[model samples]
Target: MNITYNQFLISDDKSLLQLDAICGFLGRSYWADRWSRETIAKSIENSLCYGIYDGGKQIGFARVVTDYATMYWLCDVYVDETYRGTGIGKKLIESITSSDELGGLSGILGTKDAHGLYEQYGFVRIPDRFMRKFPG
Candidate 1:
């Protein structure tokens, strides 16, 4: 599916994702900075991914790990630093949460900051039963 918000293009077409750009975004993120490109690639292959593009260059991305029936884990949400504060991230989340395939399921995401952004989409904080990242 594809959505146009202003001049940006948000789509779930994994084939349009740029590996280098994705790596670059996650590489700088506190959550996944240490992950290898191969690991990232593997993760993307197994999850449903969304990409945000400017004309043709990818500038934002998000991925969902779901069972289609029970629940979904939304992760690796990112927008280029250069494009921050331009509502791209919001649009990205909007596209993901409102998608027909994912809208009705239970969705959860972890964020160190930016709680307000996620909160707007009905993501309430569950501090007691949140998350953990064990080493492999």
Candidate 2:
């Protein structure tokens, strides 16, 4: 099946559904506990959301939180288990990186198992450069 990546439109019904479904399947960390259809829709309305479609069904998703001026944080990226190993993730990252809106900005993401994948897109771990503290 051919895959295509397109910008997510907030007002579109199908787009909203696809967004919620993707969040349901792949959202982790704080997102898994906090994201709702309404919240996801709002974020899509505000940020850069991309949906990956296989044939006609939505099968992957990614979004970048950026100022469009200096920095971009790529998040909420995932391919359906059935669609893994098929280059959808790479395409999504490529699409985001190549977009004019995200151009010339520092893009970053934190991944637990896909360092190799992100490396292909030029993402690297900044060892000891940053630290995190989760709220109790």
Give the per-residue lDDT digits (tens) of candidate 2, residues 1-136: 1223443211123343365567665554445447676777777777777777655567667777888899998877777787777666777677677667775789888877789888887788888787789868
- Give a tens-digit lDDT track for model 1, residues 1-136: 9999999999999999999999999999999999999999999999999999999999998989999997899999999999999998998888788889999999988889989999999899887885578977
State, as a TM-score between 0 and 1, how close model 2 is to the true structure.
0.75
Residue pairs clashing, model 2: none
Error of 1 at 20 (Å): 0.3
Off by over 4 Å in 1: 131-133
Q: Which window of ten consecutive residues has the lowest lDDT sum in model 1?
A: 127-136
The Cα error of candidate 1 at residue 39, in Å, is: 0.3
Q: For model 2, how big is the CA root-mean-square deviation?
A: 4.8
* Candidate 2 local lDDT, residue 121: 77
- Residue 108 of model 2: what lDDT? 83
Q: How much lDDT does candidate 1 score?
A: 0.93
